[model samples]
Target: MTRKSTGIPGLDSMLQNGFAFPSAILVAGEPGTGKTTLAVQSLFHGAREGEKGLYITAISEPQWLVQKFLSSFSFYDQQLVEKGMVNFIDLGPSIAKNPSDMLEIIKKKIEQYQPERIAIDPITPMTDLLQWRGETREFMHELFAFLKAFNSLVIITAEMSYDDIAHSQESYMVDGVIVLSYPEEEKVRRKFLEVLKMRGTKHTTGRQLIDITDEGLAVQAGLR
Candidate 1:
């Protein structure tokens, strides 16, 4: 099987040269846990390698606002976007009445761009929108199947509260699950990364400290 490195330094080593290509990974984390940064960085890393990358966002945040937030990171590459190597699609304002519309839109984008790597930043909104509607499971199944068929290394981010990580179904369905968390220890907030489950691969089993600076997220070597 072909493998695509996450390009997140220590993280790839943990996954034994990074996630398997054409697989779906779920990045679950609480607010301010650097989920967006990790996802965007992966996209940019692939883009720099001359691979087509796509970022699909469901949050209502404007394109400029999203760009502004990512601009703070040194890994944020503007040239890729300008050159059409990297693309962003916003699904926020369009489908307020139906969440299933998100599936169709995403499918269209994948078909059009055929990106080698894709990131769906914070899929929390879509999950919330599907709650009680009995469509989330179907949506996930279809989406995952579609991405696998599209042959893209896909990352889906989910906003999780302290307890949501244990209760969410998204974590169970993905090929791999990466959890970012900030636990209060000794009166200090410590950020860590846990590779919960990765199919067909031997990965780091324990939680490791993660640092998110201007260069983006990197797992502490000492923790390995």
Candidate 2:
């Protein structure tokens, strides 16, 4: 199977070189666990390798603010964004008003940008579109189908803990699941990345130590 490098060597090691192509990966984690950082870093990596990347944000946060913070990471390139190698789009307002139109809007963006790598910053908001679990499942089914129609590796970020994700439908639909977490081991706070599942790949099974540095997020050689 063809794989796409995440650009983080240690992470790539854990992932068996990289994520499988044309697959959706659910990135579950709480706030400030480097969810966005990992997604953006991968996108920028693909951009350097001639793969177009599209970043779609579904939050109310200002795009400028998002870019401002992401710019601090060394892998983030203003030049790549300026040249259209990396594209950014905000679906926050539309999703806020009508959560149902998300599928169509995403399809339109993909058609317009034609990116080879796509990242849906946070997909948890769609859970509120309907009251019944059945309806949510149908929506997720359609979304996954639509996502697979194109030849792109998709990253879907969610603000949820591992336990929360274990009970969520989105976790089961995606081709891969990566969880980032912060737990108090002894007396200090540390970050971790775990590859919970990856279809057809023998990935590392345990929570691996990770660090956020000036360049970007990197998986350490230790496991927690």
Candidate 3:
């Protein structure tokens, strides 16, 4: 199977070179755990490598505002964005008005952008809306199945904790699950990335140390 580079310094090592192309990867983590940063960084990496990237936002933040905040990170490239290599679009309005149409809308966007690497930052809101409407299972089933229809890589970010992952519908729907956590160690909270589940990849077994630097997520080490 062809592997798609994750773009993180040591993450590819964890996934035995990279993620499987055409796979849906769930990046679950708590607030402020650098989920957006990691996703954006990977998109930028792909952009640099001649692969178009699409960033779908669920919170409906303005594109300029998103770029402004991301500008602080060294990995963020305004040039790539300007060159049309990376595109950022929002699905908040669609989810708010017609939650049921989200999957269709996303499919349309994917067809429009034709991006090789895609990121759905924080899919929690959409799932919450679906679960509230009692359509989560159907949506999840369709979403996961549709992900494999493309040759591109899909990275879906979610707001979840380590415990939530075990029972979450999103976790079970994807091809891979990478949990990011901030655990208290030695009287301080440290960031960690663990590949809890990866199909067809001999991924690293335990939590890997990571740092959220100006350049973006950097894997610091393997299992303790």
Candidate 4:
């Protein structure tokens, strides 16, 4: 299996080098947990490697606004976007009334650009839009199957409120799962990253401290 670096330092080492190519990973976290930063950094990392990258966002935030926010990070490279190596697609309004439309849009984009890495920032809105467990499950099944066929490394971010991480179905469907969290420790709120699962790869089993800086998200060796 080919390994694709996650672009976050110290994290690749935890996955024994990096994530396997054609793998689907779930990055679940609560608000302010750096989920968006992690996804953008991963996409930028692939762009820097000369591999095409696609970012599909479900929120109403304009593409330019999202780019502007991420530009503060050192990993955010405008050159890659200008060169068409990194492409951003806003699917907020289109999928607001019909979540299944995401599948078609995703398929078309994947077929068109054939990106090596793809990130769906915060898939929670899609799930909420569907509002049916069966529909959400079916959509995920189809989406994951389609992604597997494309031989692309994909990251799907999902918003998790307090105590919701253990019950998220998205965690069960993906090949790998990484959870970013902020838990109270010694009267202080501390950030951490935990690898719940990584199919076909040996990875660290415990939580590690995560740091979000202007450069992006980085994992420390010790858990907070």
Candidate 5:
């Protein structure tokens, strides 16, 4: 299977070169876990490689705020954004007023941009739109089906902890699950990256130390 490089050398190595093409990857972690940074970096990298990229924000933050924060990262380029290589759009208001149309909104944007790499940063909010027990699963089924047919590398970020991952219905709906956590060791808290599950690919099994520098996320050598 063809793979899409994550643009992070260490992570690409961990994923056996990169994520499987046209796969839906769930990036679950708590707030401040660098989920957004990783997703944005991936998009920007793809943009640099001449791939059309789209970033859909489900969270209630304005686009400028997101760009402001992302400006700190060296990998983020204003030119790519201006050239329409990487587009950032919000799904917050649409999902807020017409939750039932969330899928349509996403579909419309994807159809319009025809992006090769797409990231839905923090997909957690969409869960609240589900009114019943099985609605989330059903919704995810439709979402995943759409993504598979689109034939694009997809990254869906969620606000979740290690504990929540076990019971998250969303986890079972994706092709892979990457959990990021901040674990304390020797009285110091450090960020760690772990591939909880990846289908059709052999990957590093345990948590690896990660550093979030100005350039972006890099998997460190050996756990400190």
Candidate 6:
């Protein structure tokens, strides 16, 4: 199976060189856990590798504000966006107005772009729209099916922690689960990544040190 590189430093090595192709990875983490950084950095990395990339944001913050913040990251390149290698689109407003349309909008966009790499940042908001558990399950099933059919390596970020992973239906729907957390050691706060599960790949398990620098998310070795 082909693997898709995350571009985050030291990450692909642990992921057995990269994520298996056409896989859906759930990036679950709390606020400021570098979820967004991982998503965008992966998209940018794929863009640099000549892959058409798309980032769909369901964040409340405006698209320009997100871009402004992303501009500070060294991995972000305006040239990639300008060249149409990496495209960013905001689905927040539409989803807020018509929550039911979220799935359709995403499906349509994916069909239109046919991007090799796609990121749906913070999928929790989209999940909020569904009032019924059955509806949510169906949505996930259809969404994943659509993505897999397209042969796209998709990353779906969610505002969730390790405690929430077991209960989240999404954790079961996706091919892999990666949790990012900030563990407090004495007076120091440290960021770590844990590969809880990955299908069809031998991945490093346990929490490994990670850093969010100007260069973007970098996964480091050592997890005790």
Candidate with maximal lDDT: 3
Q: In candidate 5, what are the lDDT values of residues 1-224, reduced to their tens digit? A: 99989987589888889999989999999999989988999999999999999999878788798899999899999999999999999988778887878888889999999999999988888876665444666778888889999989899999999999979888888899999999778999999889999999999888888999999998896542
lDDT of each: 0.87, 0.88, 0.90, 0.87, 0.89, 0.89
Q: In candidate 3, what are the lDDT values of residues 1-224, reduced to their tens digit? A: 98878999889988889989878899999989989998999999999999999999888877678888898999888899989899999998777989999999998999999999999998988888888789989988887787788879899999998989999988888889998999898899999898999999998888888998887898996444
lDDT of 4 by residue, 1-224 (tens): 88989999889989989999989999998888999999989999999888899998889888788889999899988889989899998888888766768788878978998899999998998878776645887788888889988889999999986468667778778999999889998999989888989999999877798888887899975442
> What lDDT is obtained when candidate 4 is compared to the true structure?
0.87
Model 3, position 126: C-alpha lDDT score: 88
Clashes of 5: 0
List the candidate 6 regions with Cα displacement exceeding 4 Å. Answer: 132-134, 221-224
What are the C-alpha RMSDs, in order, of all predicted structures? Answer: 1.4, 1.7, 1.4, 1.8, 1.6, 1.5
- What are the per-model numbers of colliding residue pairs? 0, 0, 0, 0, 0, 0
Give per-residue lDDT, candidate 6, residue 198. Answer: 93
The total number of steric clashes, by the backbone 3 Å criterion, in model 1 comes to 0
Question: Lowest summed lDDT over 10 consecutive residues: which window, candidate 2?
Answer: 126-135
- Residue 205's C-alpha lDDT in candidate 6? 81
Question: Candidate 4: TM-score?
Answer: 0.94
lDDT of 6 by residue, 1-224 (tens): 99888898898888889988889999999999999999999999999999999999887787789999999999999999999999999887888887778889999998888899999998887887775534777788888888888888899999997889989998998999999999789989999998999998888888899988889889864543
Per-residue alpha-carbon lDDT of model 2 for 1-224, expressed as tens digits? 99989777587777778988989999999999999999999899999999999999878689999999999999999999999999989988887777767778878999999999998887776665543434677778888888888899999999998779888889889999999999987898999899999999988888888989988998875452
Model 1 weakest 10-residue run by lDDT: 161-170
